[model samples]
Target: MTATAVNTTAVDLEQPLQDVESCLNLLGEALHRRDSAAIELHAASLHLALAQAIEQFTAAARNGTVPASLRTRLMQAGGRVAAQRESLARATAALDRAIDVLMPGEPTGLYGASGKNERKSAFGGSIQA
Candidate 1:
């Protein structure tokens, strides 16, 4: 697999919301450009960052109320990721079906009176008998 470098040090854990927003923007650009390697790397980094942010915020919320705007932004980011995941799944399923049709698996057959399984060609000729 190809590796894509990301500057994780640039992500501010203190400003989790903004960090997520920045990562989402980068992810959007990567997706738009169809950069699969970058996308995979970003997606993993984003997941880890988001999880850490959620845990930190959850702990902080026990002390005081979390801001409404921050919660809203997190919700929006989650929705976007969910939509992208669904789209990717659909595309993957379509591609799998196309591949199955184009390159089918081995054919099954029965042995004839000659104790051999016969095979035929597309041109109406016996390939094996």
Candidate 2:
């Protein structure tokens, strides 16, 4: 292929990588603010874009059409995506552990009174399980 054609293809491939980066940035913002909906949307979009770009890059590499610079960029982006997923999984597991530690029991409202004298307190309400 001509140099101009190869350059154009490289530029086209870069667009999707750029899109994935922007989506990841948005997802990070949403996660920081605990915006669940925005986080889900951005995460899904980023995943899709990254997957598509990886497929394209892999196909080009197999055909010996992808330039060395583009191959390096794709590999770097793939590494970043994998690292992000690992970070997300770790954060989720930490949150689960925190919730378990903080609220670790069924609500048993027994205001220190005997069963016979278990008259309800005015300020406390029983939450029936």
Candidate 3:
């Protein structure tokens, strides 16, 4: 009787996943501190780490089923990313609203070139009826 052994070696995703998580944490810290330089650096690092993690994960998936623990960690990292995005969106909207309130704009009503409110028409013609 002949028996065949299967290669149970799995891809090492722990380091790649950890690198991404570390980058995310550093980026968060930079953002919190409002350090423009650190933010830029950490943002670049985070981008690279995320790309590497994706490549590793994709390759692993192609080869075989990725372990559940690694998948859970990846999902957690994705959740953090989503949360950060949503928070930034909310803050941006609030800031935009604040700016709009502070800096008022002139209405687009019918006004003459000399800054006089006058009744105009749809086209260049007058609407004096």
Candidate 4:
């Protein structure tokens, strides 16, 4: 391949790397702010950007060595993303518990047939023969 072709390939690979870095930065900021909407928005873009970056990086690596600095940044971003995911999962679980407490479902095994202090059905009137 000509020098110009090599230069173009290098530039193409660089674009995706930059995009991935930018997406990671935005995602980190959104997580820090605890802005769910912004996080959702950036998360989608980040997924796509990261995929593209990985694909390009793999291709580039086959032809030449990837820079250590970029690899370091990618690892750091991956760690941050994992932490953020864990935090979100915990928060979601807490919210789910709170909702269940606030609006509980029907009690199970709380009462039995012909048992003293048995709970009555929702319909006020008692069951007739």
Top candidate, metric TM-score:
3
List model 2 lDDT by residue over 11-78, tens digit each.
Answer: 76787767777877787788778788997898899889888887777766665487777778767766
Across 13-125, the per-residue lDDT of candidate 1 in tens digits comes to 24777767777777778877888998898788788778877886686566455555666777898888887778778878998999999998666566656777656668887
Candidate 3 displacement at residue 67 in angstroms: 1.6
Lowest lDDT sum, 10 consecutive residues, model 1, at: 1-10
Residue 11 C-alpha lDDT in model 2: 77
User: Each prediction's TM-score against the native?
Assistant: 0.68, 0.67, 0.71, 0.68
User: On lDDT, who's better, 1 or 2?
Assistant: 2
Give the alpha carbon lDDT tens digit for every residue of 20-43 in model 3: 899889878887887879977987
Q: What Cα-based lDDT does every candidate model obtain?
A: 0.70, 0.76, 0.78, 0.78
Q: How well does model 3 score by local distance difference test? A: 0.78
TM-score of 1: 0.68
Rank the candidate models, highest lDDT first. 3, 4, 2, 1
Clashes of each: 0, 0, 0, 0
- Model 4's C-alpha root-mean-square deviation from the true structure amounts to 5.1
Residue-level error in angstroms, candidate 2, position 86 = 2.3
